[model samples]
Target: MRDFRDAKAMAQTLRDALKAKSISVSHSESLELVAKTLGFHDWNVLSAAIQSSQPAAAKSPPALSFNGGTVIPVAPMRDIVFFPQLISPMFVGREKTRRAVESAAANDGRIVVITQRRAEDDDPDFDALYSVGVVADIMNRVELPNGNQKVRVSCGKRVAVVRPAEADFLAAEVVPLEEVRALDTQAFALTSEIFEAYRSSTNTVPPQSLYRYAGEPGVLADVVVQLLEIGVEKMQQALEIRDVVARLETILGWMRAGAPAKAS
Candidate 1:
């Protein structure tokens, strides 16, 4: 077993590093991994330490930029942590959403798809929303019988939402996030354990499907994280973690704690 004190210290150091860059760590699983890795046996101690060492406020949201005179807001049906390599066809049923899709296809063929923060609320005027979302390009489209539409979109890049715009349809100004180079050590032992557990639980192997989408070893963790039916807050934490090894360990801890069962 790992020493609880050491683990807490390591987690605190990493937490400080993340805070310096305006990134917020929301997932409990990630915090647990940080504790375990540093040799802590109890996660509660680490959590208390983190709460005590909380950093200053996060920086202000950035401004949005437009392309081809069109900007749109979108809500994702599922949490997409890392964009799948293959193009995914989506069905847009809402009036505002369909209009946003159509406008994107008509203008620059691009739209931002952010995970729906409020799944239960039916109201359309919700103000608090996740700022980070992906900007996807339209690949194809078709009309449905019920006045709805189907669209095929390919993930382009990650973006930060500035603010919601008042328009005939839902629109938002966005700026793209910087891409980070993959690090080798992210393929840690915890990743293998999680993969094995996932296979045993589902009676299905993910290597083949993951390879088809992303070939690199470092990208495997991201692909697996995206496939899991976890919450938006957890997915956002995985995206915010810069260290690949730390992210994989965080996911593995969640798996061990029976996250999938709870999610289902």
Candidate 2:
């Protein structure tokens, strides 16, 4: 039987080969191969070493939140947040979501975007949702070639969903989050530098609508937030900060430090 160390070395060689080719391999796959080569009956021996190292995919689907009242059945969708410096466009498909979009368009075109909590079991009666999200305003609407409706939305502000309300469409009673404290000038300066670097690297240009809707601070903050792949929790935390300068600094710090190493 092959020695365990020999098996490990073989697995490392495979990993190195894959990396050189720009092809990715999961740690689990390598562990399984090593176990089989080493004549091990079980693969769990490498459990501690072979945690999943894959990156998470894009944002979740959109979900609805009620502001004025509560609903018995909650409709869930994956939510994508638009940071102060970013802009996002979304498609509306479901009847409820389409209705929500129409209502927001009629009522100043504002909506809160938040992530949906996965159902605990097969049952869909779960009502729990993430509390943090961004408030966005519809900037433009267009009809796609396939007859789907595409809406361009720009980040308006950060908001926390205080309570869920019942509505025919997505609705939420959200109060704007306080700005981040500006006490960390060092953080702010560092973040700004990172933001500039990201923009240069990505070659992203702000939309004209952003110029119309965003104030000076909003423009800078939105740009940075748009670049980072932040999740519901981080987005919420950023929004909860009441100080504008501090919020920018927090986002900048995240950009510099990079995202969490683990996949979501």
Candidate 3:
């Protein structure tokens, strides 16, 4: 049994193990991998906890908001919001959410994930969930020994929930959201600044693949959204804006000035 007392050591061990398996991951990727392995949402969450010398319980889960086009099947999240462009590991204990995951996996793996406005609301109705959420494709599912199912979902785009969570699990009528991004010099510059803000705000290591999506306003917006510990309200505000530039500006302003960890 190997015990990890330090984050850097665990990262090196992870990097080495991956290397031994003939897998190559960049430093940032490795850090994020280790962070994920440690049960934190992302590298920033893990790094912050380690630096603060607090228990992992003291560490907050960084929630992201994801929304995209029309979709069926809804997965309600607890505590934190979810963002697109990231693969999330969700432990499903609720029967409805479990059924939703099973149903989505059986049917092309497409579903909408929405955060419950009240964290304690295990069974949320239409009004109990937020209006905006991310639509994603379920990539894989793993059944745990304790009966909880872990599902890996790849977020695609932002969306507005047209329908609500109902019946068994949650099924909603959702519409995919499209950002009106101006593909001009000003837009490009704002996108670049947004990326820089993301790079500056993140701790431990930033993701390497984020560069691939940097030029894409929607993807970049999502990538940045996931990395920050921004509140759910501001994130929802950012999600409602149809303009990519405006969303980026709102998020960037959050980055520069910072906000309370939890949404008010």
Candidate 4:
């Protein structure tokens, strides 16, 4: 029943035992030794894992409107392009990104996740980021022992970044992009076909689990291709699409072309 969350108490016990043996080790050093005994690199990493495992207070997603006046902390994603209706977990290693995540976690857990044009850019300006990204809610976060933080986010809606503001962390003005729901007979039929294709390709059981999204073309397109062997560019392209039917068609095209499998 014991886990990383017990690390602090374990560290205290360790210190007490050491003191009984006339061993003088600082509390911090005892924590480090305990962390290592737990197979963690250091106390911070173990602490992060412990903190992240704690349950966050239940909170509803922020009520954001596409009014162009909505401002939020912007976190730059290095590799992945997030999409609406998708829940993703990512690591925050960059200092600015960690600050942004902290700011969002402190507030409403609402933040704009924009993908960088190049993953190599450590300090990317506004232009270096894709304008179209997802407005996501930070569901959970934990500080890692390696000076990085782990964040789990639930992507809500598509948004276009109006402009970036200068601040301690990157802040941006954005307007939510309305998905054009144009579901028709053809679109509906295509959705079912794509779901089957995804199931066949990925060999996932209980295909009915994805049936919840069967009625929503835009959401279906976003969720299915994410499981495919598509590149980030293709995924971003899918995010950029506003039309439901067009997005599905593009996703189908990728499937037919036999996109490269994602690296495990």
- Model 1 gets an lDDT of 0.60
TM-score, prediction 2? 0.50
Candidate with more favorable, higher lDDT: 2 or 3: 3
Candidate 4 at 211: error in angstroms? 2.5
Ranking by lDDT: 4, 3, 1, 2
Q: Which residue runs of candidate 4 sit more than 4 Å off their true CA positions?
A: 1-63, 66-70, 199-206, 260-264
135-232 per-residue lDDT for model 3 (tens digits): 88898888999999888888877766544534576887555555677454555677777656655655323456666876677667766775667667
lDDT of each: 0.60, 0.54, 0.68, 0.76
Which 10 successive residues of model 4 have the least lDDT summed? 59-68
Error of 3 at 183 (Å): 2.4
Candidate 3, residue 65: how far the Cα is off, in Å: 22
- Lowest-scoring 10 consecutive residues by lDDT in candidate 2? 47-56
- The TM-score values for the models, in the order shown, are 0.61, 0.50, 0.64, 0.69
Identify the superior model by TM-score, candidate 2 or candidate 4: 4
Model 2 regions more than 4 Å off: 1-79, 118-128, 145-147, 182-188, 191-221, 229-240, 244-253, 256-264
Query: Under the 3 Å rule for N, CA and C atoms, how many clashes does model 1 have?
Result: 5
lDDT of 2 by residue, 104-192 (tens): 77776676665555523222221455555566778898888986688887765555554455677656555444344433555445544
- How many residue pairs clash in model 2? 28
Report backbone clashes per prediction: 5, 28, 15, 2
- The TM-score obtained by model 4 is 0.69
Instruction: State the displacement of the C-alpha of residue 49, model 4, in Å, after optimal TM-score superposition.
Output: 41
